[model samples]
Target chain A: MIKIETCLTPEILSLHQLEGKIAVVTDVLRATSCMVAGLNAGVNSVIPVIKVEEALEYQKKGFITAGERGGVKVEEFTIGNSPFEHMQEEYHGKDICMTTTNGTVAITEAKKTAKEVIIGALLNVGTVAEYLKEQNQDIVIICAGWKGNPSLEDTLFAGALIHRLQDQAELTDDASFMALAQYQQANGKVADVIQNYASHAKRLSGLKAKSDLSFCAQEDYCSILPILNGEAITIKKN
Target chain B: MIKIETCLTPEILSLHQLEGKIAVVTDVLRATSCMVAGLNAGVNSVIPVIKVEEALEYQKKGFITAGERGGVKVEEFTIGNSPFEHMQEEYHGKDICMTTTNGTVAITEAKKTAKEVIIGALLNVGTVAEYLKEQNQDIVIICAGWKGNPSLEDTLFAGALIHRLQDQAELTDDASFMALAQYQQANGKVADVIQNYASHAKRLSGLKAKSDLSFCAQEDYCSILPILNGEAITIKKN
Candidate 1:
């Protein structure tokens, strides 16, 4: 049986051996959701950088810079961390240099140890699941929690992916099982659950991103599978 | 409102500031459960040692050496990890020098940073909740997961404590919220939930300790509040 593991937060990612495994990194509040929407809207690729300064360097090289820190966009960046911003016609066919509070750091960390790194969010969960099932590789779902602490939305997203892959993969640890149980608890009212209970979602809502939360909570918004090939995240080739 | 935080595994305890906070340490599969039972059955105090060698040193000092490594009793020790053995009259009024795999390590670690450390298990969850509610301090429920990894039984036990204290305490982080949600999902069928899904319970079951699982799953089997006071876990004086 193919094995599936979960790193609840990037802090615990070191405890998991990522060699030869496909890592699915997610930040459901915004980072990954926007990445999916951006790629699906015809942005050529997303270059995830760890800092706003790195994104600025990419801006010098003619890439559209996008980032956020603590729910607000970095003033220096061209665009903020939002799926709607990424979906605009102005960004179509352009490569984005992106940074965010948690998602980019998690992606950078997972790419170092994982054989392949992919982004997973409600927007493209079904496609991510189908791709993993076809690849038949051992999997690790990395939740980009709020600064090394686990976040409800990211964990719930991990559970959603686990639930989809349960038939084809065996949960090898208690973390994966817990994620699945949490997902089962929050399946139908995911948006309501996050809006009402998730701390990060509340932070976003405070910044007037309630619509973003509702949009990110939707499943299969696009067929795009954002995979980190080297330093850039582009659509996975069929 | 009293704040309740959960460190899902002892590995994450360092991330939490435990000073001035009451720490509830639990290992539901056996260790903490048996500690509660042993104390209730009149074991004077439980000295949770990290190593069998230390327990042996305590044995030389006339304390009863009782511990298990991997669900089996040490050959040199007088007793194993079963709560039933701890409930026996033979061990009444004796001080137990104990060591287990996960629980003891967690207790030792928590004692270092927490203002007060108390043992928690299904066997004495009611008393734990009552004591914390009365103390009115910020609380951290530490789940002694399997060798630094999160365990189903322990996380569920944290959820149980969180559920009991939810009316009196505010959950401070996502881990506490997630634990409560999981507890809600497993409420009224906690034993069946662990029996069917907990990884540690499955390990114990493989070792013919199925009854121990049921015993550990029981609520308020004893009213004893075991608190660590300078190297020994003794009943808290009202």
Candidate 2:
């Protein structure tokens, strides 16, 4: 397996290395978690845009805008960058033009290398892993950190994914080995293990995100694989 | 004060975003630590170069070439990337052209933004911190990680430096907070804290770089400040 790894610090995620392979975009704190929740709640599609201007342009093309900055929803957008917002009745069958500080940027970057893209969060870690195993292809998981730097939390999620992919794929990258070793040392207690990630703790501290952390922390919360083909996120459902 | 905070992923050290500050290149591994030792042992100047070829070129220009790859001295270079190699009597008063995988790249990047460039490692952390504290200028600490990704060790060092300077400046970035928290949590217990840094440990195992780690981990080993001027590193004397 050709597994290459890159830490998705928010800025790096703004544009991922789309050189090759299937890209797994992971934003455990809010964005991908929100995407999972949105799809689970029956949203039709998520159109990711990096800039608010692009999101507005998507809205002009008859899409619904959903976003939050510093955890607050943009005034005109339909949703904040929260899974809590995704659990509502209004999103069913709606095309979501989603933008956030990190998640969307990561999606844009992942689109560069990924012929096939999958959204990864702790919420769907199991399904994502199982689906990747079924596909049996070279895969790259890009962790979208809070900003332009690698936050410990994103690396932890990358570690978790690497841990799951062990035995199924050959690891060649140093970061891959490090992630696997870290995940192994944690011994599957991902929640407590990830507490070392200060950004995760900080993002979850004072908002509805505190509870969302548990939601994201739950393993295999959904069996559905939300894959990105062309431009929209849809479930594998098979 | 302008406090630019960067993470220490081995990869990030090479992929730096340095702009407008005095750049402080940090490699908790062996490069900066070795550079500090070399300067302490009375080496007149240390030239930081990215490519081995550049070091060779510098050697042709009447400079001593000192460098290593994967812990062993490169076949063509005169020195290994070790603090001990740097302390050799032959290096005293000699201008040394040095290169390494990650730290040198970061120093190069920081050069673009910093008015002054300095090297910091665990061995010189206290001295660097004290110098920054006294200089009263906006400072940036670029952690040269093992490769290009964040390492717990380097971030811990960044946090340590930030903690020392936290009273002097407001951390205006998430990178600052992340480093601060990491440093606060992992202070003093360096070995246990960085045990999850499997890649680094494995590289050290291959290189038998234990002494380098031990010396790098030493507190206050060097009193001199290795500053980057033009293209070479020079001692900012007491």
Candidate 3:
């Protein structure tokens, strides 16, 4: 049986042997959600850079830079890390160079070891599961948790993705079991549950980003599967 | 208000600011549970060393040595990592020099940075909560996860500990929130839940340590709060 595992945060990503696994990376509060929304909206590709300076450098090369630090948009960037920004008509057909507090770091780190890295969020959770089924590889869902700490929403997303697998993969790790348990407890009201329970959700609410929370929480908002191809996250054409 | 945080596994323990926090380290399958049971049954103090070689050195100093690796006893030690062995008549009033795969590493690492390090397990969870309440300091419950990976039983113990704190301490991190959710879902059947769900419990069951699961799952089995004072874990006298 193919195995399903979870890295609750990027800090523990190194502990997982990612060489033979397809990593489904999620930052449900925004980053990966932005990628899915952008790709679905006709953006050519989303380039993820670890440093804000790297994204700025990409801006100098004509790519529209989008970035955030601690949920607020970087002052020098063309846009912030939000799905709405990614879905805007002006950004359609344009390429984005992006960086964020947690998501970009997780993406770059995962690229180092995972056989293939794909962006995952509630927005495209179903598509991610479908892609993984086609790949038929052992899977590890990597959650870009809040600053190396586990976050509720990302874990909840992991559970949702695993739930989609539904006995096709064996959950060999406790983190997978824990995620599934959280998803089960959420009882399909993940958005309300996260808004009320996640520390990061409260952080975003305080920053007036409640709308982003709901948008990111929407299941199958897009069928786009954003897989990291070279340095750019482009749609995975099934 | 005091804060409650959780390191779901020791691998992410460094991400936490442990300087002023009371670190409650738990390895519920055996190690910490053994300490709580042993101390409660009258072992003088438990000295946690990080290596089997160090445990052997302590045996040379006439201390009773107990250790395990991958759920089995280390051959050179006087006893293995079960609560029953620690409660034996010969071990009463004797100091134990112990080391295990994950628990000892967590205990030693926690001691380096945390202002205070205390052993926590289902066996003495209530006492741990009481001690933390009296101390009135921020608490970081560190789960000694299996081989630096998160484990179900340890996370459940973390939730159980946080549940006991229950509004007394602010649940500041997502890990703490996740733990509380798991504990609530377990719904007072933690022993059965763990035996049914925890991977570590299954491993122990394969080793014929099923009784240890039920024994360790017993809440408040002892009021002993074994705390690190230098390298030795002595009972904290209220």
Candidate 4:
């Protein structure tokens, strides 16, 4: 029997019994979204770094550095956190090293225990779900919530994924059920619900990142499965 | 400015930055509900212990011992986790020492950081909200989620409390807003929603704790405010 559990935030990642499970790490507004876009746009691979200095070290090695902290572009980096930037032709056919406030932290943590780790977002929900459907192992959806607290967008994205896979797998925990219920509550109107309720969206709006909000909310906008390979996220070439 | 944040599980309690804030600890299935019921029944004080052995020690000191582990009555305890037992005439005018699988652990953790800690449940939502309104401090609703994961019933109860306090307090973070939205989705039918989604309720049903479920769902059934006095939980005289 396949069981699916959700770690609603990275803060609780340690409490999850994740041995032998596949971890789908999500940061919908917008770190994982950016990575998915980069992989789909034909970037060679995306390396996730937890520190700005680590990203800078990769930049010194001639890799394109991209990330943000507190919703602003990091200093001395090649690009900001906007997923649309990953869609730029300049980054095509190149390796990108990235970090963000929450998503990288979650990915780094999940990698410690999960047998396999994949980046997930609303943009790649279909791709991630399809990949997980074929796996016979248990799944843990890790939501990269805002600064250690649960975020509406990530939970909604997890719910969207759960809604797709519920019939195929056991929704074994309350967080999964809660996320699916929240997703159902906002099923037909995802953008509107997220705009009004997501704290990170409101924070980004305050920082003039409205375009990133709209980009991150587009379901199945990207088809690439960005799976963690060693320390870098690379496209899973099936 | 009074800000209200909801920690959906004790596992993420550290991420909440709860220092100097008032912590409203909730374990809606039974622990906090029992504590609230005990206070309403005119119990002089209730002590929350983290271990079964500590509860036993308190029992040796003539305090009525009460608690459960894994949803079963602990061996050598005065009673199991039924709130109705707390409502019994025998417990009136006496101090009760209590512990449980999740709630007391959360209360013990919150006491380490919170300026004040109070028990919250559907049975005393109005009383808890009224008390918070009178205080000029930030509030953190710490949900004693089941075994390091978020529980639906606790989050829904937090949502119900948020629904009541949203107009008066700044719902400072995403968890608070997410919870309030959930409460709104089940506005007039909390019991039905919880019955269908809460994992702990289903677990209890397997253990034949149906009466406990019905009693825990009653909103404002008791008006007593359970607040922490050093290490013991006691009725707030005000």
Candidate 5:
């Protein structure tokens, strides 16, 4: 059976809970969504780092780097953490290095436990679902809630995943049933998710992250699987 | 206008946010629930402190002090954070000094920002609702999310308060919509909240808080509002 666990915050999750599962890392606001967009636009591989300084260090090595602080893309980086930035022809078959506040921390943390960590967002939910269905071990859909708390969007994404995976998986109460109901009630309205979820609204109201939000919400925009391979995220080679 | 904000976690809520709102301290798993239960059962007042040692110190004043560590009540103390414990007629109409892990920290934090702090949970939704709706300024509904990030239950409670006060106020992107979604989805499922939203769930589950879980789900179990007066949570005079 596919076993599922949900963590309200990233800080409290254990490697033991993640051990050997095909972990799916989601930070739907922009990080994971941006990564997927870049890959789909033809970037060769994306490297995710936890710190701004770390991503900056790679810039000299010819890696196009992206950095974010407090949701807005840092202006000094190779790109801001916007999915729109990734959807460019120049990015095709290129190497992109990224650093984000919450997404990268969660990705790094999940790497320590799971044998494999897969990135998911609405952009690639079906792909993740299909990928997990083929995998034999249990699956953990990790919601990288903002600042380690349950942000509305992250939980909604998890709820969406759970909704799809219900028949084939067992869910933990650590995942809120209410989250699933809300996402369902919205009828998977991508627009509503953008407007109603916490971080998305914050981004919209504060940062003019409309394109990023719209791009981030684009369901199944890419089927390219970005898997964690020791300290970085890379698209799986078929 | 009435307002409610979800703190989302027991940690990381800048105690600074408590600056000017009506703080509603909620810990449905037990803390605030037990405090409310204690009030209904006749405890004169609850002196909330951040540390257990402080709770112990109050015992010297000839007060019936209560303490809890993970979730269960402490030994030697007259009560753990439990509503059932609060039902004791012997404890009614007498002062009870109290300390618990997350809830107390939350109360202490909000005390700094709020004009007045009140205890809230699903158990006292309507009364809290009526109280908030009458307010004209921004009211902050603080949920002591487990250990400093948004928990499922707290956000839902915040959402319930927001839903109740929707017509009377506006919510920041940080909480209202996000929290509203979570509450709508969870719909007062106690088991789901503990398992999904709370960071300290496994520990609480280990402590057998499952029963506490059900008991805490009852809406407005008591109408006695535990209003924070100066440094104490006392029955709201209505």
Candidate 6:
């Protein structure tokens, strides 16, 4: 019997039973999307660091530093959190160290006990779901919400994943059902739904990151499955 | 400049900015509904206590003790958490001390800094919304989710309230908008939607508390507005 659950934010990660479960971490607005883009573009392993200083240290070791604090590029880092930034040919074949306000923190925390931690986002949700279905483990979808509050984009992405996997998985909690309902409510217009409704998308719009928002909202545009290998997130080459 | 926000659960209560705000607490499964029902039935006051011992002490001081843990009436208590129990004639004109698994704890926490705190549920949502509009203060709808996780019924109730209040109030965050969308999706079938979809409702059904679930799901069945007066929750006589 495989049960599926969702932890809406990182704050409630500790409450969910995670031992031996597969944790799919999503920060759809940027972090996980950026990871998917980077890994899909042929980057080497992407190290998810928690602090800006750690990313800077990785820069010193010849790895590209990429992160954001309040939706803007961190100072002295080579790349911003925008998925579009990782699509360049120069970024291909390079090692990238990434950090963000929510996504990396969630991944770091989920790595504590999850037997396997896989990065998920709108761009690669289908790939991630298929891989998880094959793994046949109890899955916990951890949404990296803004700060400590739930984010609509992450929840929507979780719903999209659940919609893909519901046939084989039991919806174990209300949050899962709620997310799937929201996803079904806005099916086929996910980008428009999220762009018009998500708080993070609105915030980025205020910062004039419309292109980044559109880039992140594209569904199934990438096929890379970034899985946590020890301390680094690298693409699973099938 | 009146902003409306929502705290989905007590776990994320700290992340929301609640100072100088009128906090509306909703525990629709039975706590807030029970409070609304008791106050409507003419109870002088309903004191919300966090611990069972506090309710027991209140019972010793000539107040009716009411609460539930694990959705059952606490041993020797005057009543369990069913709103139906509070609608009886004997509960009229009396002071009641209440505690519960999620609702009372959220109310106790909201009392710490909210300029004013009000209890809300599907039973009194219309009245609560009208009063909030009249107050013209920033509002935060705090949902008393099961333990630390977000519950479907509470979120749906929050959405119902948001649907009523969105015309005049600013939907301040992503959560507020998400909730309103949900309410709109389940517009006329709020009860059916919750009963069929809410995890708590299913749990209670498994416990054969379908009657309690139905009682809690009725919209606008009561007219009382439960507001925090100092430390006790009493009816607003407007």
DockQ of 2: 0.20
Chain B TM-scores of the candidates:
0.97, 0.89, 0.97, 0.96, 0.88, 0.96
* lDDT string, candidate 5, A1-238, tens digits: 6877666557657523677778788988878888887887788888888887878788878999886888777776878877878878888888888888888888888887787899988888887877787885787777777765556677777777777777887655534454566567577585566665565465565454765676677677778888877666677876
Please state the error at residue A188 of candidate 3 in Å: 1.7
Count of clashing pairs, candidate 1 = 0
- Mind sharing the TM-score for model 6? 0.97
Give the range of the ten consecutive residues with the poorest summed lDDT in model 6 chain A: A201-210
Poorest lDDT segment (10 consecutive residues) of candidate 3 chain A: A201-210
Clashes of 4: 0
lDDT of 3 by residue, A60-92 (tens): 999999989988999999999878889999988
- Order the numbered candidates by lDDT, best leading: 3, 1, 6, 4, 5, 2
Query: Among these predicted structures, which one has the highest DockQ?
Result: 3
Quote each prediction's TM-score.
0.95, 0.75, 0.96, 0.94, 0.85, 0.97
Residues B1-238, candidate 3, lDDT per residue (tens digit)? 6798999888887788999889999999889999999998889999999888888889999999997988889998899998999999888899999999999899999999899999999999998988888888998899999988888899999999988888688998999989988988888998988888788876775444888788998888878888999989999886
Q: In angstroms, give how far residue B200 of model 5 lies from its true place.
A: 9.3
Model 1 chain B — which ten-residue stretch has the worst lDDT? Answer: B199-208
DockQ of 4: 0.73
By DockQ, highest first, what's the ranking?
3, 6, 4, 1, 5, 2
lDDT of 6 at B221: 90
Q: After superposition, how far is residue B233 of candidate 4 from its true place, in Å?
A: 2.8
The TM-score-based order of candidates, best leading, equals 6, 3, 1, 4, 5, 2
lDDT of 4 at A202: 69
Give the Cα error of residue B89 in candidate 6, in Å.
1.6
Comparing only chain A of model 6 with the true chain A, what is the TM-score?
A: 0.97
Per-model C-alpha lDDT, please?
0.89, 0.72, 0.89, 0.88, 0.73, 0.88
What is the per-residue lDDT of model 4 for residues A1-238, given as tens digits with 9 covering 90 to 100? 5699998888778778788999999999889999998788878889998999999999999999999998889989999889888879988899999999999999999999899998999998988889888886799999998888889999999899988898888888989988888888895688888887787776876444787788788889878888999988998889
Better of 3 and 4 by DockQ: 3
lDDT of 4 by residue, B1-238 (tens): 5799999988878778878999999999989999888788877788999999999999999999999999888989998889888878988899899989999999999999899999999999988888887896899999999988899889988998888787788888888887887887786788887777788878876444887887888888877788999978888886
What tens digits encode model 6's per-residue C-alpha lDDT throughout A138-219?
Answer: 9999999998889999999989999999888988898898888888878589899888888887787544478878878888
Q: For candidate 1, give the lDDT of residue A48.
A: 97
